[model samples]
Target: MARLNFVLLIAVVFSALYLVRTQYESRRLYVELEKASAQSRKLTTEKERLQVEKRAEATPLKIEKLARDRLQMRTTTPAITQYVEYKTAPAVQKASHE
Candidate 1:
């Protein structure tokens, strides 16, 4: 009977230790999950902000302004327009001396 009591005490102690370890691991994982979710939310907000700015920059007025200011381009009038065709040259072979 004394031996049985000793064995039961050992079993109970091991069970308690296992439970404590499992609970600690669960808490740690929960905290990590919360942090990852917060980061996802922050990145999603930043993506939305960048999308809004992209739309504004793609407007026709903005395109015209960029072309005129950066490229120094102007719309051509009908009187000054000319069209050119691409010309191809024939290949010539060089004479080699033996």
Candidate 2:
């Protein structure tokens, strides 16, 4: 009867240790989950800020300024315009039909 009592005591100790390990693992996983959620929130906020900057950068006046300053471009005026004319040869058209 003492041997049976000793076995039961050992079993209880093992059960308590197992419960402690399970609780530790659960708490660790919860901490990791919270960290990941916080990181996601930070990244989302950064993305929104970048999107706002992108929108501001895409305004037409800024594009025009960038074009004029960076690309040395200007609005078209007839004084600086050139015209082109296209005339297809009759010989080339006849060959394509064959």
Candidate 3:
């Protein structure tokens, strides 16, 4: 009877320890999940901010300014325009044998 009681006690102790370990792991994983969610939110906000900045940077006026300033481009004018002519061989008229 004493041996049976000892065995039962050991089993109960092991079960309690297993339950505690499980709870601890669950809490740890929950904390990690919260951290990951927070990071995700932060990254999403950063992405939105970057997208706004990108749109602002890509405006047409800004592009034109950059082109003129950085690339030394100039607007086209009729004074500087050139015309090109393309010449092709005259078509050969085939003699028709009646």
By TM-score, highest first, what's the ranking? 2, 3, 1
lDDT of 3 by residue, 1-98 (tens): 99999999999999999999999999999999999999999999999999999999999999999999999998999999999999999999999999
Cα error, candidate 3, residue 69 (Å): 1.5
lDDT of 1 at 16: 100
Please provide, for model 1 over 27-92, each residue's C-alpha lDDT reduced to its tens digit, 9 standing for 90 to 100: 999999999999999999999999999999999999999999999989899888998999889879
Which 10-residue window of candidate 2 scores lowest in summed lDDT?
89-98
TM-score result, candidate 2: 0.82
TM per prediction: 0.75, 0.82, 0.81
Q: Give the RMSD in angstroms, all C-alphas superposed, for model 1.
A: 4.8
Alpha carbon deviation, residue 44, candidate 3 (Å): 0.4
- Residue 55, candidate 3: alpha-carbon lDDT: 100
Q: lDDT of all predictions, in order shown?
A: 0.98, 0.97, 0.99
Q: lDDT of candidate 2 vs native? A: 0.97
**Candidate 1 Cα deviation (angstroms), residue 85:** 7.6
How do the residues 1-78 of candidate 2 rate in per-residue lDDT, one tens digit apiece? 999999999999999999999999999999999999999999999999999999999999999999999999999999
List ranges where model 2 is wrong by over 4 Å: 91-98
